[model samples]
Target: MGRIKPQTLLLQSKKKKGPTRISGTTILTCNLVVGLIVLSLVATYRQWSNRSRSQAEDGLQNLEDTDAVKDLKKFDLPSYAILNTSKGFVFVELHKEASPEIVDKFLDLCQKGYFKGMSFHRVIKNYVIQGGDDIQGLGAAEDWIMKGKPHSELAVSPKHEAFMLGTSKAKGGSKEFDLFITTAPILDLSDKLIVFGRVIKGQDVVQEIEEVDTDEHYRPKSTIGIINITLKQEI
Candidate 1:
């Protein structure tokens, strides 16, 4: 054996060669770190997106609840009644200012489900279609009307016109409710009944209702009724 020189040792080390051996543990740890970083980024982005969408939906719901209060006040718009009937939907603009008592009463009744299944027992063609308290649950006619609180008590009368809603005392003195929609301009009933509102839209529905055949007492041969009445007003 001969002693190797320092220069020989240096040259041999330089020739020694290939890449450093990276262990399996090191490679796996590095890949796991990168995967965790990507997963964190994705979670953060999803949370942010969900929060933004929830905020947008809440904003829209609040807007609907208040319904542009500033605009309603500025325009002095009255509340509306959306009357849903078998024929179709009829929109009535309530005369809240003109007759607050009756208008409120009608709205109260609607809220109470008092007219839920009430029918237009009296459907006189070319004149009017009456409802409010007659005819039971869309299934059969009651042959009797549920009159307004007291037929004996009288209220101030309003002008009569086409599509106007009014109520009259029954011949038995216990009949009539909101009394219902008019299909034509009736001048005679001005003093006889109290008018609270008028149909603003769906006059065609009212016409169709007016044309429904009725029996001798003007009771509709087929039941025609209010499925529901919804009031739209400020929150």
Candidate 2:
């Protein structure tokens, strides 16, 4: 047999090696591409997961806020005061529209039974009738400062007209529980007093309270007790 040509031998050797090299290169390239695809998939999954978690938390927070607002809306604003006094019942309408904070404080106090069985310590005929004292003639039991902060200035201007409620300032310059109702218009006390309500019904009972005998200090001689005070919501 004739020996194979050198070119033929070379060609046969190239064909054998070419297949192995191509297979190895194809495998390496495929591995690289597969690895890149896996990494991209993982990155995309992580990003989507984080965004979903954030959206869930935000939705929960908004739901909680909405429930809180709904709960707050359940109670209507206090509109009137039904005072069961020793003399008779006196009904006063709160000026919640004008002085919301002050009226709210007053209603809160009344609801907590703070004014129950308290005496009308001060009664000045044709002027004012002051009350809401825990101890008779000793002054108010609770301080009358606004709930959150000390308001150095007034929110609403006081009009000390007949049946208008006023906050009597204590000697220490802080308003205490001493509340008063005017029998007639006295505009001079407007700057110092915070008028929160006015008597809408039962002015006769207030007049009777004003007629109660008092001493030189304007404290009542006999106990003019408040049996109870209740807040009523309009509509």
User: Which tens-of-lDDT digit does each residue in 1-235 have in candidate 1?
Assistant: 9999999999999999979999999999999999999999999999999999999999877876684764554236438888889999988877776776666667767788777777887776555677866523222222222221232343433464678876653422342354667665555456555677778889998998888888777888888888988877631
Which regions of candidate 1 are displaced past 4 Å?
Answer: 1-78, 134-158, 169-176
Clash-forming residue pairs, model 2: none
Worst 10 residues of 1 by lDDT: 139-148
Error of 1 at 17 (Å): 98
Runs of candidate 2 with Cα error greater than 4 angstroms are 1-75, 133-158, 169-176
TM-score of each: 0.53, 0.58
lDDT of 2 by residue, 1-235 (tens): 9999999998898777443345788989999999999999999999999999999999987876895665554336668888899999988888766776677777777878888887887676666677764333323322221121222332443484578876644323334466778776655556556787888888999998888887776678998968998777762
Per-model RMSD to reference: 11.6, 10.6
Total backbone clashes of candidate 2, pairs 3 or more residues apart or in separate chains: 0
Task: Name the 10 consecutive residues with the lowest summed lDDT in model 2.
Answer: 141-150
